[model samples]
Target: MTKEAWDGTVTKKSRGLLDGSSMYRRLELRLTDGSTVKVRVSRDLWDAVSEGDQVTKAAGEDPVKQ
Candidate 1:
């Protein structure tokens, strides 16, 4: 199904360095419909989130590419 926004609760969090410099962060979430989704966000955004936190992202905006 298509969605305009992604609303979910974070279930897991991971962080690492890319190319030994840039930081990368990933979050595993449980959507409202019981589906799991993984999304990558920037270090700044990552710091604003934590496991168990609820978050919403614009459908077309890819956080990972930021």
Candidate 2:
């Protein structure tokens, strides 16, 4: 199963208008294994995020990156 955890190591973040009233935050993760992954979190998650936050998934559990 895909793991649901935050590694807390954010490298990049972006803000944009998601819909008409809501906003979106895109997070970029630079893993310790020298891999890059991107995740788009809801505004609710914004409060939980900081300068060094990341979202992670398990190796066999997570779907392959496209």
Candidate 3:
């Protein structure tokens, strides 16, 4: 799989069930490139960040708070 990297300010945080069975965490980001996207993240990473926090993900790596 191709790995992608991005840096952005988080706009929102949320959690929900997928198919009423699997739980998931998500972050909505406003990227440095001026686009917005939502990405699924681990529970630890989800708890580590908040709205408006800056975060970065390197290619093939998990996102980290900046």
Candidate 4:
């Protein structure tokens, strides 16, 4: 499917850690239009975001290039 940008607020976040450090992360968002979307993200980007933070991201894209 084609991808598009969507604005949303982060609703949830989680991480995968290795060796006592975060290696991967994921974010779940509630879209402005009231839809839910989830995306896997890098640890750096994940660290930069928090619950209730507004963000823009491309939908239908793998790896969620925020």
Top candidate by TM-score: 3
User: Model 1: which ten-residue window has the lowest total lDDT?
Assistant: 57-66
TM-score each candidate: 0.71, 0.52, 0.91, 0.67
Candidate 1 lDDT over 6-36, as tens digits, reads: 7788889998886799877889889889999
lDDT to native, each model: 0.74, 0.60, 0.92, 0.74
Residue 55 in model 2: lDDT? 53
- Candidate 1 residue-pair clash tally: 0
**Winner of 1 and 3 under TM-score:** 3
Query: What lDDT tens digits, residue by residue, belong to model 3 across residues 4-42?
Result: 999999999999998799989999999999999999988
Per-residue lDDT, model 2, residue 66, is: 17
lDDT of 1: 0.74
Cα lDDT tens digits, model 4, 16-61, are: 7645765667799898899998867767678888798887766765
lDDT of 3: 0.92
Tell how far residue 17 is off in model 1, in angstroms: 3.4
Q: After superposition, how far is residue 49 of candidate 2 from its true place, in Å?
A: 1.3
Stretches of candidate 1 above 4 Å error?
1-4, 18-21, 62-66
Q: How accurate is candidate 2 locally (lDDT)?
A: 0.60
